[model samples]
Target: MTPTSLELSTLGHRIRHQRVSHGLTLDELGERVGVAGSQLSLIENGKREPKLSLLQAIAAETGVQVTDLLSTEPPNRRAALEIELERAQHGSVFRQLGIAPVKVTKSMTDETIESLLGLHRELQRREREAIATPEEARRANTELRLKMRDVDNYLGDIEKLAEKQLKSAGHVSGALTHRTVSIMAEQLGFELIYVSDLPHSARSVTDLENGRIYLPPASIPGGHGLRSMALQAMAHRLLGHQRPTDYADFLQQRLEINYFAAACLMPETASVAFLAQAKKDRNLAVEDFRDAFGTTHESAGMRLTNLATRHLDIPLHFLRVDGSGAITRVYENDGLPLPMDVTGAVDGQIACRKWSARSAFDEQNRTTEHYQYTDTPAGTFWCSTQTGTTAEGEFSITVGVPFDDAKWFRGRETQKRATSTCPDESCCRRPSTDLAERWTGKAWPSARVHMQMFSPLPRGVFPGVDDNEVYEFLDRHM
Candidate 1:
């Protein structure tokens, strides 16, 4: 294996220690090893990777074995400090400061190096703390979303695991039943318990010691919410996830558990077969898929994005926009022009007013899905949006594909069409010239600021979760 920088530094320190003990100068060692003195100096300073042959020659000249030259341990405390300082200098945290790195010299005292290392540690801690901010969270979400897009949002390992769990629970076909979910939990040595006193900050809490999965008594309006939450809790165990190290790691775990839950709710083998047949019949619809899987409209739509692109070769986008038109959740691989902030994050950005996701709010028939074809700077795309209400407020779940792939969907014939020029101020953000002239210097609207905008993300083992509340709840039950 190729040696890491730290390993090289350790090896170099060991070689230099041996040379010093033998009372040999660089020239004397180099002459004995058949290498230039300057080259030997570079090797001794860990500035160059030495070949196996060179290492063997050096070991022979120093009266030691090759393994001794390759030892990972630093020769002395000074060597350890130097290796650490070297690593800190090359780190991203130091590089981003745009300042010259402090060079380690033979004259520098160990105490000075220790103080520098302490400062470096403090800088690293502050940097990690900064990542818990909302802007950093958004940036991390954007990066994860883009990565999911690149992979077509499909995860085969989770899919296979879900399928295996379902089969083990004796789920052969149809919608996965509550009994089957219970059985699956039981098989995993967990008993699903309904309780009225779940922690306010937690959706569900798994008590590993008691082998109980405590859930709220009331089910969410859509059928799959409770099961999905339970499965997500179980996923933490099945996926072998540890406490997240950073905000990015926490976001990743959230995505993974959600993915695992969706996979369990909609088994890939069965769901794909059902969708494939639907596609063949040219009757693919989100509502139909939702009915078949007995999942929420949002879950069905998101699941389609996961499977459709990978299995059916149809690239698409999905969006979940709140009543005020903020893009709460979005995934696009079809070149849909989404409004993004300076950090390339689209979560808080407003969706175009003319797009179906926003227009669906004004539809008279809230019972049915609103379908439309929208022309934008990127291209024409068809979308079907379903608006629903929760405790939070009304939100719309939308699934759309490019114009060419629209023919394969049920809402392809809808004559409802609109145009959007988003990311352009004139499209929706800016007022008309007449309206601007009339309202300017007169309008002093008080903007309602969300508290989350000002607050730092919760600090603890789990972000946003009250650890005390959770521990208390577990104690009450245990």
Candidate 2:
């Protein structure tokens, strides 16, 4: 574009940005700059260009640098782009991305400028890739979790097939015994081996070439949980799921297989009836469900969500967060807003420290469940959480219901109450002044933030994470 044309747009953009950031109306800004509001509008809209002296006066009145309002350099492509990037970096909207401002200067080396340009190009490329940005990826996962949760964690087709298989195996009870699980494996002609010496990381690897499924001791040291390990392996064969093409598909298929395995262990019809009765005695506790069906508390909590949404007609929310307050799994149908990313998912996002889910880890009392009531801008919710130490260090499982819906829960009358404006100002992200003042020097938490931790890349990278292991496993299976 010509210098005159460029100057008009540049001056308008800078003036409008400075005015909006200062929260001044067109009339107020025009009055300060000694111009009529209508005339200022024409200039801001680029229909009229201001003289250099007038631009300098306007910049002075608006508390902006004169260089920002006028093209101090020629209107070349490189200069124009550098100016635009600088303008965006200074604007509130772009700064809100939480990125440190990288100031570009005419004195910078050509190599340094090229690097910055390369970074911008890479960011554009990321948009074409699936699930752009860490925030959006998190939101997408959260959305999927809730969508699967709403239907009571049931997949009709898969559940039907599972039910048929179990019924044929003469297994339709509270919990499918290990013996029954083993019997089904035998029926399928897959060799079952109980070895005392199995790799801790290897959870029943299926070898199609050898046709064998190996299991470790029922209870291994160092918190290697055995719950559903065999069933999860068996699910691979029963579900007949091939390798998924993309990460999202991989995630969905993995959860579906897990749900299918749970269906086999606690069959829908029986588990729902048990949960229904448990709710009747005003003892809708997840531990009761766990005891009645021989499932782990995490499994029990998920099962409760499934059966409750399907049979009890109660809308609920569930969350599983690790010790670092990272949300691993989350689902809600109660209309209470949870933290979400650009894609509208809450997974992999940090949970507020004051919320029941995150605070439950602080109690360190796994013997009894902790309950709290919190109010958000959207609505108030009553939540219950339990923390336990397992193979994966400490983790918390929490469930919540809306205030109106809390009446249906057992501990709705708990005197403990807290308010949360999560993912908003004045929440866990930015605590009260007193808290920071009190804990700032006393507490030394190493965030240890790593970029790789945010990646949704699949695990099972043993010894060396090169492609060799995957190739070997595929060859054996083939």
- Which candidate number would show the highest lDDT if scored against the true structure? 1
Model 1, C-alpha of 170: deviation from truth (Å): 0.8
Listed in order, each prediction's TM-score against the native is 0.75, 0.63
Query: Clashes in model 2: which pairs?
Result: 139-345
Backbone clash total, candidate 1:
0
Tens digits of per-residue lDDT, candidate 1, 88-207, equal 988999999998999888899999999999999888866754557677778889999999998999988999888888899999988877788899899999999989998999999999
In TM-score terms, which candidate is top? Answer: 1
Clashes of each: 0, 1
| Reference-based lDDT, residue 378, model 2 | 76
Report how far residue 473 has shifted in candidate 2, in Å.
Answer: 8.6
* Model 2 agreement with the true structure over 335-435: per-residue lDDT tens digits: 76777666666776788877888888767467888889988887888888888886768889998888876776678889888887777766767768988
Q: Each model's C-alpha lDDT?
A: 0.89, 0.70
